[model samples]
Target: MSIQRRHTAQQLGDCFKVAAELALPVLGRQSRHLDGLTDIKLVHGIVSGQGKLSGLRFTHAWVEGLDDNGVKYVVDASNGREVALPSDLYYLIGEISPSECVRFTPEQARRHLLDAGHYGPWCGAPFEHEDPVPGVAA
Candidate 1:
């Protein structure tokens, strides 16, 4: 897969929502705690698809739950417990193949977030390039 131009917050968040929705079915059978949305996760991408994979081609998806045992349990929200969300359930939209998924890494996510300040909705938090708020301690 070609290296995708880095994603912005809206772009990456959209992708995360995609992975989250797909996981919902699996999560529905396990925990209701997902309703609370404790936090969202950005995790490592894995290799699956034609051709030898390296770096970017091998992608990652954002998951809602942590890895427990050998499998990743998802947030059910309806039941409030963890259920395994299969890795196979994730696939990028409109990609020629699964491998084309533009993986979102945590570091990339951080950068996207930092960049968001330029156009993000935080009306009070100043951009990093600008003067700091007296006590905000960002």
Candidate 2:
């Protein structure tokens, strides 16, 4: 058999670079809420970014943990807790192997956020997002 390169889901920054190269404006990454697959993602452009998120500036971030279904989850750095964020609360980073989903329901997992104890804080915070991207947001 011939060797083939695996096509892992691209990272948020990698996606950005791809977007920049291909000129495709919009793209979403797994948010820091689902777990680590691609359920929620980071949607950003090649310009300014969001400074305010849910009364927070998004000063910190971290990958929550993989849900039962394989979905990705992210968390806030400060509290070390998984947030009950909306499904559409996308982030600026892109996903790798995004198709994988969390096995459990969003509500159920959220209830166990504090108990699961898989929370963490990111050192490199999200920067300013670029202008609106294409094929991403309406």
Candidate 3:
């Protein structure tokens, strides 16, 4: 089954909540406690555009694992701010490899969300930018 359900920010937030809850116990318990997120695979990396402007890239954090049917899917909790890209929407890019997902504390995760340039409500950053790509001065 091809899962096409788009998760609302609220729903996605809950996913992060679960990650945070699971995260609390792992802190200091084990160094890589946040990696698996119980059943979810949390990943932080860049997913890039595959079209002519394929040079365009985005830095993001996402969760991936099998659904009830065992179909793997990528869950982007960024709330569409910086292209909450589905796995199919873009290909992975840079040294920020998704295959090597790193676990972060709740606080670290929050900072990463903001640092990755999220423009949504959870980001708490004062500014919002439509373009995910960093601007270069001419």
Candidate 4:
């Protein structure tokens, strides 16, 4: 079956928060499925796609990892549902450029969060210097 495109009103601009939660066992939460994954990295970048966010380049975050078979996948929970797609497919659909992405390991992510005090576009990407959502601090 083909992967379905799903979006939720609540998840519109919460990509960073969702990604952080998924990548680290913060708030006493952990994704059990990620236990078997390897080389996991939290990524932040500008993304534009063909759905509600069509034609709009915005800061987004997600997790990337390799499965046991060594296939790379992009896992996103920003839509309020976890979706894992092949990294190439996800990048193509989101119009994301590898060179423009900022990646962090779980340890690095924790440090950044502690240093920046927020889930963020910490690398100062031209498109993302501030929080995407105002007053939310996520």
Please give each candidate's TM-score: 0.28, 0.23, 0.33, 0.78
Compared with the true structure, what per-residue lDDT tens digits does model 2 show for residues 25-105? 122333333333444332221112233222222212222334666644443322222244323343433221223222223
lDDT by residue for model 4 (27-50), tens: 354565566789999998767756
Q: Model 3 over residues 1-138: C-alpha lDDT tens digits?
A: 121223233333333433333333442322232233334544544434344425544333455544455544454433322223334443343234445345454556546444654322133321112222134221
Q: How big is the RMSD of model 2?
A: 17.8
Q: Which ten residues in a row have the lowest lDDT in candidate 3?
A: 124-133
Against the reference, the lDDT scores of all candidates come to 0.34, 0.28, 0.38, 0.74
Off by over 4 Å in 4: 1-11, 32-35, 127-138
**Quality of model 1 by C-alpha lDDT:** 0.34
Better lDDT candidate (1, 4) = 4
Pick out the ten consecutive residues of candidate 1 with the lowest summed lDDT.
119-128
* Best-to-worst lDDT order: 4, 3, 1, 2
Prediction 3 TM-score vs. true? 0.33
Best by lDDT: 4
Cα error, candidate 3, residue 42 (Å):
1.7
Tens digits of per-residue lDDT for model 1, 33-95: 333343344332332333222232323343454443344343322112233344444332212
RMSD, candidate 1, Å? 12.2
